[model samples]
Target: MGRTRDRLKKAIAQSRIPSSHGIRYANELLALGAWFREHAEGVPAFARNRDLYAHVNEEVLGDAPIDLFEFGVREGSTISKWMEVNSNPASRFFGFDSFEGLPESWRGGVGETPAGSFATGGAVPRLDDERVHFVAGLFQETLSAFLTQDYRPTGNRRVLHCDADLYSSTLFVLATMHPWLDPGSVIVFDEFDSPLHEFRAFVDYTSSYRRRFRAIARTGPLLARLAVEILE
Candidate 1:
């Protein structure tokens, strides 16, 4: 009788909705949201942020010296991964973070993560190689100068990895980073399941610019991968 009861419970649990289904359903809604926003305005489009980076490196970057940008480098593990997969001598990697944590609490009811969470007390991992650089500060304070003055500004494909959790921070990075994106660039969002933050920012940014992108790949159920390439 106990065996039967255990089997029954297992059957019921299997019959229940799987979390991946929820991810799919949420992503579908996100797709619709992007569509509506695109029609209304424009739209544009991470992982450990490495799997997607590897996908892009293999599929799009082959032999090309690309520029990689990672937002939210907590322990700098992702930065190290990028360097590992990319061997092009001229390639450069830029990691941006407050090194303190989220600038604020993530948007409403999203999760328990609070403002200033993930703070590293301004200490970040040091990568000795010159090919890699770190920009330490709030996004608003640092991104503009990097976009305009510090970066080489030309001759490389752009790859962006966004790990920041808040809606405002994600939105700011998207809006600020848009002008630099070109066709063939790849953007990977590490926590895209937060509908109100990363997801919403993406829909608005793409719609606002009337830009077009296509979902090219996905990593697990959390990361969203997108590509902006000219259709020919």
Candidate 2:
């Protein structure tokens, strides 16, 4: 009976939802979400966070290859989970980290954690996945190198996931990636809901722009800091 129930649960998770995502990548997202939840047990309690990243990515679907840059990837877990679920042959996932740990200081005041406290000692678990790319060193330095030398996009269909933990690095990415952005570009703030970091960065980005945007939420509390926003 327990086995039967498990099979039924798996069946439900594997089921694809109806979406305007077209055929290929649309169905892939549903499956990837299921796989991430199933096989990757004993993982950190970051599924919900990654799900938020994936959900917003789904809303900004395109037939062209998917290009993504993740500010912080502790180990390649989230991207691996994402690849398992979506399994996009064309999609490319990039993660940027100090690898050695957090930066020196976060400039403005942040939350409970100190500026350098979150450092992981630069030892992110390595994985050999074709879809994933790992960028080591400070984002401020590595990012510009990538745009000119390493990264070449098709339609430049990109998703920027900023988990840099501080405003300086976060704002730096926004400035550099701004020119590459098209109407389809999607930016994910891992801590966008935070009172100090992301919100402050968003204010700076919006301060100069005259155009307004529509917001979409897939889960959690609708308040700004409590949830992630989809600006369209």
The number of the candidate with the highest TM-score is 1
Off by over 4 Å in 2: 1-47, 62-64, 104-111, 209-212, 223-232
Instruction: Supply candidate 1's per-residue lDDT for 71.
Output: 91
TM-score of 2: 0.67
Q: Compose the digit string of candidate 1's lDDT tens values, residues 118-196.
A: 8889997888778888999999999998888887766888888888877788789888987787767777676664555
Clashing pairs in 1: 42-206, 42-207, 42-210, 43-206, 43-207, 44-206, 46-188, 46-189, 100-119, 105-115
lDDT (Cα) of model 1: 0.69
Please give, for residues 90-144, the per-residue lDDT of candidate 2 as tens digits. 8888888887656755422111454565567777657777778888888888989
| Stretch of 10 with least lDDT, candidate 2 | 218-227
> What is candidate 1's CA lDDT for residue 130?
85
Backbone clashes (count) for model 2? 3
Q: Which window of 10 residues has the lowest lDDT sum in candidate 1?
A: 39-48
Question: How many steric overlaps does candidate 1 have?
Answer: 10
Clashes of each: 10, 3
What are the Cα lDDT values of the candidates? 0.69, 0.57
Q: Quote the lDDT for 210 in model 1.
A: 74
